[model samples]
Target: MALDRPTPVTFHAPMVLAVGLPPATLSRAGVVLEPSGVALRESNLLDLRSDSAKYRPLVLLVDAELYDFDPEAFDMVAQDVGAKLGVAGSAREAEVTLGQLMAALARKSAFPPPPSSADAKTDKWDFSEVVAAVAAQGGRE
Candidate 1:
């Protein structure tokens, strides 16, 4: 996917779209956006290290498109991890901290659908009721 629209954006799937560092330009990283949450490759950790040590602890961003993912699941994970690390007293606190990332995902997903080819070619595809037909096809999720 190009950086602009980032094709194959995996609207219904979780994926890490990009990463940024101060000295280095924003580069794409290979992180699996899973339904349960984001999974980071070992390499991603190394890249993150060049940024800030405080941010070294790898946390992930997640959304509905991710595989088997639910927002509440992450809160549970955060709570468990935080308990082990002796950070917040409960996972509910972690949930409050992750508000920004969660909000961003929600907004991004609300984007309008891309222009379909049907808009330009009348004979090729029909725009009217196309979404309904696709929904009926059942192949689309």
Candidate 2:
């Protein structure tokens, strides 16, 4: 009889797909992102949605000059797709935007919410304080 084996899991790579940026810009962006453990790709505005769905990138850096530059709208789109959006006028700015997003995400996951008082099923023994008080009084006088 053959033993059962577990299936391998498929995890998405840490990626950044810069939308509407030229290949030349992307080449520089790639170099900037090399040490951050994130792979960078360039996708035109036409394929933005499809590429976004496929990559599920941490940051979708966009060239604001390509179209109407509405940061708020892009932010909503990013939030809808579960990623942080970055609009860049230059390659260096894009790098900074990505860095800020990375920092924000790191800070978010580093600290957990304080434990709720109601959820804690404290096993503290009742009358323990009273017992301590009696002992301090030297055998109840």
Q: Which residue pairs clash within candidate 1?
A: 14-33, 15-33, 34-67, 35-66, 35-67, 35-68, 35-69
After superposition, which runs of candidate 2 have C-alpha atoms over 4 Å from their true positions? 1-8, 67-73, 102-141
> What is the lDDT for 106 in model 1?
68
Candidate 2 clashes: the total is 0
- The true-versus-predicted C-alpha distance at residue 2 of model 2, in Å, is 14
Query: Compared with the true structure, what per-residue lDDT tens digits does model 2 show for residues 1-141?
Result: 988999888788988878877666666678777876888878876777778888788888888686356666567657767877777777777767877766776798799978898979977766988788779898757
Question: How many clashes in each structure?
Answer: 7, 0
Q: TM-score for all predictions?
A: 0.22, 0.63
Q: Residue-wise lDDT of candidate 1 within 1-141, one digit each (tens)?
A: 656764573232332222221111111122112333743222232443232232332343222232133445444543443311112222333343344344666687789768898667655556767876887788755
Candidate 1 accuracy as TM-score: 0.22
